[model samples]
Target: MGFLQPNLPQLDLESWRRGTRNERMRPLVAHLCEVGFGTPDVVYLFYVVKIGLYLLGAMAFAVATAGVDGLFSVGDWWSEPIVFQKLVLWTMLFEVLGLGCGFGPLNLRFLPPLGSFLYWLRPGTIRLPPSPALVPGTGGRMQGTVRGPVDVVLYAALLGTLLVALLADGTRSSGDLPGAAGLLPVWLVALPLVLLGVIGLRDKTVFLAARSEVYAAIAVTFLFSGVDMVVGAKLVMLVIWWGAAVSKLNGHFPFVVQAMMSNSPVWRWRRLKHRFHRSFPDDLRPSGLSRALAHGGTAVELSVPLVLVVSSGGWVTAVAATVMIAFHLNIISSIPMGVPLEWNVFMILAILVLFVDKAAYGVGDLSGEGVLVLAVPIGSAVLVVLGNLYPERISFLPGMRYYAGNWDTTVWCFTPSGLDKFDAGTVKAAMLPHQQLERIYGEAEAEVPLFTGYAFRAMHTHGRAHFALVPRACGESHDDDYLVLDGELVAGVVLGWNFGDGHLHDERLVAALQERCGFEPGELRVIVLDAQPIHRPTQSYRLVDAATGELERGTVLVADMVVRQPWDTDLPITVTPAPQVEC
Candidate 1:
């Protein structure tokens, strides 16, 4: 890669465009292998400024809460329940505002750089309700753009109520911590939570987009007063760590670590980056080092929180807190794609507030509590287990599987006309992917970023399966007939917000597109890949022809996937072709 300009493919324009998709991607892959994404220095600086701004915003909110004083003097009120509750609401507001994850150019969000609130508050925008057929009154049309004026007004109210709740000062609680403020008024927090729940039923996009899984779970804790509130928060954090660790016990996670390390802005040495993979070309499997990192990281996530929860202050608490803070700091510094930056910041604060500062609230403290105390964590664990076993039925956020790399993913192949249909049909925040590319970098230069994105996906194990399914989905049609796009990008355009969740665009999404675009049977094909179960070595897949419905259903071996390079398209596939009955 170049010092200033990204290293362009070393080929003549005609020759570059003449090659097949993966063929043209070879040089781009090599470039990424050396300098992943090669994100400009200015972009990194911009993120740094944003992180500072988020931190400053949180501190300002902290001060506004009754007991809190200056930012530097957080020690005086850091353990206050109100302080922590406000932080949770504040972070949720930040995320739902579109300033959080999936923000900016790294996620290919250039035009407005965000989609959350922009799409949610607009009356004509699309809202994806999970499984409309299963619920009454939600059965109008499965297409994503089905929001009515009521949906828009409710969404706006949810946002507004949350802000008001966050700004509302705490009322006195019966808790024991001296000089520390009580909780935000029960109704203040409760009203917003209820609105969030109601809006979520109508549209899961707004829920997951706000990271409702994390913040909502935390808000549920505020309902309990005194020591129970502290214990509830502690248990929620435990679920996040342990649940994420358990989810990572799959063959796919090592590949995630390898890819993330290579793309890490902090790890700038090209030699060190290459070490994460087995070889430059012949083999691209995760290296021994990547496997060790994944295992070691999992161990920390699973075990350290236990120590943090049980230890009552002093050396043990201090040590565990420092280690976990460093852990989050490392992830933050890496600048992982999807830019889940603010989430990491919140985790750091959680460690300090729930575990370190208020270290007295341990497992023993829960003995004073009722059955409800045990129920919340137990319920969260059950949900995690269910999500792992049946990913199609649950969003990964609630599943508590952050960055396991084994996620339900999809790849959409659209013919030029199919792409045009999407542009004409959707309520869009930005132009379609290729159009945006061309607008920024002329038609000729557009292939640079375009192919770079393909290489990025190919770097993961799922990329192989996605491509392997393409032929089966396409059948007799030439592969180049369709422009392949990540389902997340399509989700961002259609659903308004997406943070790496495949639930946003599964079979239901295919129906939605067909309803709007009315594509020919062969014009649009989709590959939906489910995350592997913790107990299983294979992941399931479905290929749907938009106009005609599902063409096949089957499984892809995780064993076969982990062994190949990201660009290797020869991965084996098992198909159960469906009997086509015309609708």
Candidate 2:
């Protein structure tokens, strides 16, 4: 890949278009092993620039604290408890602003380059309520998904409260060292907590975008006192690491490592990228090397944190901290798809302060607040366990499975009429992926990036099964009649922000879209795949048409998907048979 231009694949689009769906995927998936997405180095540099700004902004927020100094002198106040607390809040604020996770070309957001504040602060964009029938104000005969003036105000209020807290001076409650700045004011900490929860009741999209899972938990930690507060935050971080590690213990993760490593600019060697797959260009299943890296990383995630958290400070703590710092830095270098660069940077800083600087504040230092001591970890543990056991009911984020390949995901197939209706009928911040791609890469050459995205999805285990099932979703013309797109991209367009969570674009979002755009039977067809239950070998799936509702439901064996090539989509189906479609 060049500095400014992408390395387009050498293929005849006219002839490639004439092949079968499986046939069409052959060369594109092959191109992935050699060229990956062929993304230019400039795009990755763009994300690096954003990361620098995030850190620069964090420094600005930290120095705003009265006692926190060392704007240029790193050693003076870098270890301050209040500084760590402020940066945590800063990361959350950055994410919720829609500038963090799913921003820029990598996430396919071009014209506006972001979705959160642009859509959330506006009054008429779509919103997804956590519940409809039960939450009193969330649903009505006509106002279930519309983001009215009230929604806008609540979103604005949440941002305002967080800013206020970030700017507030730290106070020394019963929870500080002799000369140390205290934690954030308890009321300030609790206000955004309440607002996020309240706003979540109205729109889960905002709640998840703000990353209520990690940030809100840390916010709650600020409400505790002294050792209790520090201990609470440590437990929250531990759960995040452990939960993500545990969730990766599946047949799916190697596939994730394969695709992510391929797209990464750091791994510029094409042969090295090819090795992640079973055989370069032909077989795209995770190779043995990919499996080894995936497993080794999982072990580090699972074990190193225990040492970091329990080691009462010494050379042992130093070693563990180094390992974790390296772990996060590698992820940062990868510049993975969602571009969660700032979150990883925050983790590295967090490792320095929480584990190294404050290493002595482990469990042994808790200030006899036994109730809070038990509650935070216990609450976090339950979410992780339940998220794995029943993924459909809970989002993967709250379930603590962010980086794991296992996530509730979807594929949307839009008819030409369906695409037009969607483009015209919805109030969205970004244009459709095809429209944006056409403008950026030109209409003739857009297919490379488009199918590269498909190859990226197909590299995942669910992508294997999801594609195999697409012929069923489209009923007849897999080529002539449908334009297949990733549901996450669609969610970004219509819902404003989606961080690779399928729950954002599942049946709930489909129903909302039908309500707004009113598609005919086959105009908008979707394949909804839930993450595999931890104890179950099979994953459940649903096929829904925007107008007709659920037409089929079934389970695909995880074993079947893990063994296939990226372009290989044939698989046996069980439970519901043929889709209910009219010729």
- Which ranges of candidate 1 are over 4 A from the true structure? 1-12, 141-145, 367-371, 577-583
Local distance difference test scores for all models: 0.81, 0.85
Error of 2 at 348 (Å): 1.1
Supply every candidate's count of residue pairs whose N, Cα or C atoms clash at under 3 angstroms.
0, 1
Where does candidate 2 have its weakest 10-residue lDDT segment?
172-181
Clashing pairs in 1: none
Q: For residues 232-343, could you state the per-residue lDDT of candidate 1 as single tens digits?
A: 8788888888999999988878878887887887888888878887886556678899999999999999999899988889999999999899899999998998999989
lDDT of 2 by residue, 1-583 (tens): 8999888778888898888766777787777766678778888888889988998888888788887776776577787777777887888889999989888888888898997898898887888998788788888844588898889998899999989988988875534543266667788888888999999999999999998888888778777776676778888889999999999999899888887787777788887888888867667788899899999999999999999889878999999999999999999998888888888888889888788877888676766663566587789899999999999898998898877888899999999999989988898888888889999879987877788788778878888887898999897677789999999999998888878999999998888888888999999999999899999999999999999989889999899888877777678778667767998
What TM-score against the true fold does each predicted structure earn?
A: 0.95, 0.97
TM-score of 2: 0.97
- State how far residue 564 of model 2 sits from its true place (Å): 1.0
The residue-level lDDT of candidate 1 at 292 comes to 98
